[model samples]
Target chain A: MNEILADIERWRSAGQRIAVARIVDIEGSGPRDPGAAMAVNNLGEVAGSVSGGCVEGAVVLEALELLEGQRDAGITSFGFSDDEAFSVGLTCGGTIHLFIEELNW
Target chain B: MSSIYESYRDALQAEEPVVLATVIEGKNVGSKLLVFGNENIEGSLGSSELDRVVSRDALGMLEAGTSEVRHYGVDGEARQDDLSVFIETHSRSPQMIIFGAVDFTRALAAQSKLLGFRVTVCDAREVFVTRRRFPMADELVVDWPDRLLERIGGDLGQRDAVCVLTHDAKFDVPALLSSLATSVGYLGAMGSRLTHEKRVDRLRSEGVTEEQLSRIMSPLGLDIGGRTPEETAVSIVAEIIAIRTGRAAPRLSETTGHIH
Candidate 1:
């Protein structure tokens, strides 16, 4: 989050809506620890990263969906361990739980 | 009046400790509360009782410099999964204090900053400790390493590091003695095997116990065969990470199990 603050402020001051996705939990061999964050603006620009390249593209999509009101703010899990057939999985075989929501607060 | 995020941004920019608690599960998702180091709070978790309890726990997490998801009842009761709050702490960054303002100190300071450490370069010679020499260091102290440690030793903890790059006995002896008294997790000295043996004898003569002496990672850094300052810095920080993670400093291709 500290790394992306500058971009977040720039986008926010420009009157662009933004969504934030934060890794709430990780299991097994996770590349990044919990509290890792990524922010995506309405324009699809991104800041920071929740995973080591893996799952970040999917996280951006989730953030965009949240911004579009396509889903409520909630926890989304991505990993091969899940039975939900998550196409995007971490190469390190780690399950990451991300909480996606708008940056209104 | 500032919003919760404004307060959080200001606190973070000022390097003041703060924690932001957000509800990720249960009622009122996205509700946030900014818990400052002074116990002051802004915003709410939709319930005053819940806010009170979460604020208390957030303070504890802030002290530990950790972030994680916690479960609680609607009113913040323990052992209840009615609500899940993500407590993200922004503590003061960990510190790396180098006792020699030499070429290695410059490289080490830059490398430590890359690893998110607040680097401080200290030396007894005012000529050696200068901002021009070490622009990456967060602080430059022109004083004996022992004297500087005496003022800040109590604040050192398991996440902090102290490296005595000054190979001279007059400088490194007092530095090692004072560093031994601190709780710093990584206490290393840069030297060869012969120098370390001599230094160990000096420390023992000064009444440092075998156990206390064991804490020092003399002949510092991994066996990376690095001789240059830049390469030595990489080896040193890698050793620090290996120490913190309790890894044996083996190459991933040669080892099994988790690579993280």
Candidate 2:
């Protein structure tokens, strides 16, 4: 969050709807720890990251869906054990749980 | 009226200790409660009872400088997972107080800053401790090492560090003695092996116990075979991280288990 505050303010002031995804937990061999976060604007611009560049694109997709009202805010998991494993699993073979939500608060 | 994000951003920008507890898996997902170190709270985790319980837990996590998820029953019961709150801590940066503003201090100060430590370079010689010399230092103190420690030692915790780069006995003796009095997690004195042996005898005579002496990582930093000041700075900060993480530094290829 600290790393992306300037960008968050820039997007907020520019009247961009934003969605935030924060890592709530990591099971094993995770590159980043909990509290790692990323924010995505409705325009698909992104700031910060929750993983080692492996799952972030998928997270951006989740954020965009939340922003578009196609999906409600909830927890999303990415790992080798996930069904979409081949497409967006963590290369380190760790599981990461992220809470995706619009930045309404 | 300030929003929760505004309040949180202000606290973070000011480098104050703060925590954000968000209900991520339960009724009222995304409800946030901002918990400050003083036990003051802004916003709520959907109920006064939940707020009371989570604010307490968040305060503990803030002190440890960790963030993670915690489960609790609705209305804050003891053993239930009805709600999962992600308590994200925003603690102030750990401090690195470097004694002696020498060439090594410049490298270490720069490296410490890179690792997010609030670096302070201190020495008795005002001529040596100059802003021009250490542009990356958050503070430059032109005073005796012991005096500075006496002033700031109370605030030193398990996360803070004290590095004594002064090899001279006259300055280092007092510096080591006073550093032993603080609870700083890392206390390392820079000197050759023979110099450290002599310093150990001096420290023992000064009544520093064997256990207390063990806390000091003299001839500090891992044996990374680093010769240059920049390389030595990397070794020292790497040692600090290893100590904090409770990991013995070894090659990743050498160890097979969890890398994290």
Candidate 3:
């Protein structure tokens, strides 16, 4: 989140709606631990990353859906443990639980 | 309108220690409590009692520079799992105070930065401890080791480190001695095995307790066959990590065959 603050602020200044995907939990050998986060704007721009490139693409889709109003902000799971829910899985075979939410705190 | 994100971003950008405790599972999932060091809190976790307990725990986790998900009851009871709060800490980075401006210092400083440590290079000799010599160091102090520590020792805590790389007794003794006076997490000295043996005797003469002497990882760094300064820097950081994580620094080659 710290690394992406500049980008987030820039997008906000441009009046872009933003969604945040934060890793709330991880099981087994995860590349990034809990608290890892990524942000996606309505334009599909991304900042930060929640995984080692494996899950960011999927996270971007989730963020876009949340922004599109087609999906509600809530918990989203990815990685091998929840492969049924997500087509993508962490290459390291760990499960990561993320909370997708609008930056409307 | 002001929001918890505004305060959290402000505190983080100021490099102040802060914790963002968020409810990720259960009622009011996504509710947040922004916790500061002095028990100053903003936002809520849907219940004041839950906010109180979570803020207290968040401050503790912030001090330790760790983030994790913890379970609690609706009102923050210990034995229930009705809610999961992701207590994410944005503590100030750990500090690495290097007490030499040698070739190894530059490498070690860069390595420490890679591990998210705020690096400080200190040496009494102004000629070597230059900003040009160690451009990556967050601080370059040209002062006596003891005096420098005197100004900053109280701020050192469990996540801080002190590395005395001055092999000379004149500088090494005061460096390691002053380091012992602090609660820095890792204390190490760089030298050969024989050199550290002589240092141990000198330290004993200075009345350093056996327990304090034992805390020093002399002949610093893991036995990773590191020959170059860069490789040695890796070994030293690896040793610091192993010590911090309470793990044995065993070479993977040596850990086979079920010797344990």
Candidate 4:
């Protein structure tokens, strides 16, 4: 979050609508811990990351959908599991829960 | 129309501690509550009672510098997992105070900053303690170690560190003694085996007890066989991380352990 603050500020000043995806919980063997954040503007530009590159592309898609109102802000889980599986699973075999929301308070 | 992003950015830029609580599960998905010291809060969860309870828990997580999802009752009742709140804390970065502005100190300060520590390089010698020499350090203090610790020791916590890179007995003895008074988690002094023995004797003569002596990591850093200043800096910072995480760091191939 600290590293991407300048970029966030720049995008905000240019009046870009943004959505944020934050790693809220990790089940096991996660690459990044909770609080790892990624931001995506309405233009689809991204800053920061929540995973080691495995789930980021999927996360950007989620962010754009949230911005477009196609999907409501909520938790999105990505990983391989018996119950459900994501196409972009974590190679480390951990389930990460991300809270996706717009930048609006 | 104030955005949470603006509040978060302002808090971070000013170095003010803050925490963001998001309702990830239950009735109010994506709802947020911003919390600071005490019960000062902005925004809210769906329920007033839930907001109160979650704000209290957020402050605790902020102090520990932890981020996690916690379960709670819908209206803040206990023992009922009706809601999940993800509390993300923005705590100040841990600090590293290096008590010698020597060659090793420069490398260590740079490495410390890279590892997210706010490094402060202090030395009594005015000539050696210059901001130009340690551009990576958050601060370059030209003062005796004891005096510098006196001003900032109260803020030191288990995550902070104090490294005495000055092998000189005159400077190291007071530095180590003053550092011991604080709760800084890692206290490392750089020296060779012979220098450590001589320094130990000097510390004993100065009336430092055996218990206090054990707290210091003389011949500082792990046994990584690092000879250069840059390599030694890596060893020291690695040791700090291992110590903080309670990990007995060894070569991965040498031990069978659960990697978390």
Candidate 5:
């Protein structure tokens, strides 16, 4: 979050409604730890990352849906689990739980 | 309407220590609170008693720089799970104090910044310790290592690191002694076998105990056979990572290990 603060500020100043996705938990061999964050603006502009390139595309999709009011702000999980809720999975075989929410607060 | 967010943003922008506590579960879902130092909390957990207890616990967690989900009774009583509060602390960056300001110091400072450390490049020689020389460093302190450490030693913690790149005994001896006095987790001194041997003898003469000497990584960095400053910095950072994880620095393919 600290790393992306400048970019977030730039985007916010430009009047971009942004969604922030923070890694709340991880299971198995995660490339990044909990608290890793990625910010996505309504324009699809992105800053920072929650994973090692994996699941970021899905996160962008989620952020866009959130901005569109198609989904509520909450946790999104991605991994190689058999549940198959998310098509994109981490190559490292780790499960990451991300809390996706608008930057309203 | 913007006061809470503004305060949070300002604190984050200034790199001040703060924590955002959110009611993630139970009755007051989405309720928010802000905790900073020992000040009165800005928001509530739907109850005065819950706010008081959670604020106290949040301060302790902020000091340790930890984020976790804590369970408590509706009114903050223990041994109850009526509510779950996620206390996410926004701590100031862990410090990396490099006591050398040499060529290696430049690379190390750059690498430390990449790792999200607030790097301070310190050396007694004002000529070498200029900010222009190590622009990547967060601070350039032209002072003796011992003097600087004496002032800030109390703040040093397990997450912090102290690198003594001054191979010269004149600067390194005092630097090592001062670093040893602090609780800094990684105390690395850059040197070779002979230089480390001589340094050990000098440290002993200065009343540094064997236990304290063992804590210092005399021949700093892993045995990666790195010759250049940048490569050496990578090796040193890798060593720090390995030390923090308590893993034997070895090639993964060569050994059967848990692969943490």
Candidate 6:
């Protein structure tokens, strides 16, 4: 969140609704630890990151869904350990669990 | 902007040592309690009792600069897993105090800053210990290393580092002597094998125990065969990481087939 403070401030000033994805837990060799965050505005702009580029795209998609009111604030796990082989996964083979939510609070 | 977020941003941006405890896997998920330094921070994690217990634990996490999920029962009972609170600690950046403003001092200071350490270059010689020489350093102290350590040593902890680059016995002895009195995690010195051998005897004479001497990584840095100052700086910081993480510094040729 510290890394994206500037962007969040900019988007907020412009009255852009934002959604944030925070890594709540990581298993095995994750490039980033818990609390790594990424924010996405309603316009699809991104700020910060929750992984080493491998999962940011997927996180952005989840954040966008939240912004679009397609989902409620909840947990979304991604990694090699997931059943979907074709899904976005970390190259390092680590699992990361993210809590996706709107910045309404 | 939400008042809670405004206060959180203000405390965190100032590097005032704050913690944000969030309920990620429990009832009332997304609830937040912002704990900053000893004050009853804004927001709460459900109940007042839960806030009190989490605040105490958050302070401990803040001091250690670690982020992790801790389990607790509703209302914060001791031996239960009804809730999981993510305690994210935003500690002030760890400090790296480099004694002696030499060529290595300049390179090391730059490297330390890159690694997010608040660098302080200390030397008795005012001429060398100028801001122009070490512009990257957060602080330029024109004082003996012992005096500087005496003032701020108590605050030093496991995340902090002290590097004594001044091989001169006059400076090195007092520097090591006073540094031993602090809880600073990493104590390293710059020198060759011969210089370290001599330093051991001098430090022993000055009453530094063998146990204390063991903590000092004399002849600092991994044996990366780095000749240039910049390369040596990389090796030194790598060594510091290895020391903190307890990873084996495997030289390529010396290691068995496996690199992992």
Best by TM-score, which number?
2
Q: Candidate 1: which pairs clash?
A: none
The digit string of per-residue lDDT tens for model 1 on B14-106 reads 999999999999999999999999999999998899999999999999878889999999998999999999999998899999998888999
- Give interface RMSD, per candidate: 1.0, 0.6, 5.2, 1.5, 2.3, 3.1
List candidate 6 stretches off by more than 4 Å.
A81-84, B251-260
Ranking by DockQ: 2, 1, 4, 6, 3, 5
Instruction: Calculate DockQ per candidate and list them.
Output: 0.75, 0.88, 0.46, 0.71, 0.38, 0.48
Evaluated on CA atoms against the true complex, candidate 3 attains a DockQ of: 0.46
What is residue B81's positional error in candidate 4, in angstroms?
A: 1.2
Q: What are the models' TM-scores?
A: 0.95, 0.97, 0.92, 0.92, 0.88, 0.95
Question: How many residue-pair clashes does candidate 4 contain?
Answer: 0
Which ranges of candidate 3 are over 4 A from the true structure?
A: A81-86, B250-260
Report the C-alpha lDDT of model 5 over B1-260, residue by residue, as the tens digit: 56556777778888888888777668866677888865656877799999889888888888788887789999999999998787788877889999987899989999889888999999999899886889898888989999999999889988889999999999999999989999998999989989999999999999999999999997889989899999999999899889877998889999973454
The sequence of per-residue lDDT tens digits that candidate 6 reaches over residues A1-105 is 888999998999999999988888888768788888899999999999887788888888888988887887888998773546666887777788888888876
State which docking tier applies to candidate 3. Answer: acceptable
lDDT values for all models: 0.92, 0.92, 0.90, 0.88, 0.86, 0.88
Question: Ten consecutive residues with minimal summed lDDT in candidate 1 chain A?
Answer: A78-87
Arrange candidates by lDDT, highest first: which order? 2, 1, 3, 4, 6, 5
Per-residue lDDT, model 2, residue A3, is 92
Output the lDDT of residue B15, model 1: 91
lDDT of 6 by residue, B142-180 (tens): 999999998999999999999999998889989999999
For residues B1-260, write the lDDT of model 2, one tens digit per residue.
Answer: 99999999999889899999999998998899999988999998888998999998999998888999999998988789999999999988999999998899999999999999999999999899998999899999999999999999989998999999989999999999999899999999999999999999999999989999899898999999998999999999999999999999999899889989
Candidate 3 interface RMSD after superposing interface residues: 5.2
Q: RMSD in Å for candidate 6, one decimal?
A: 2.3
Pairs of residues at least 3 apart in sequence or in different chains that clash in candidate 6:
none
List, residue by residue over B180-255, the lDDT tens digit for candidate 4: 8999999999998899899999888989899989989878898898999999999999899999999989987898
**Chain A TM-score for each candidate, in the given order?**
0.92, 0.94, 0.91, 0.92, 0.93, 0.92
For candidate 5, lDDT tens digit of each residue in A17-96? 99988887778878877677899999999999988787899999999999999998777899873435545888777788
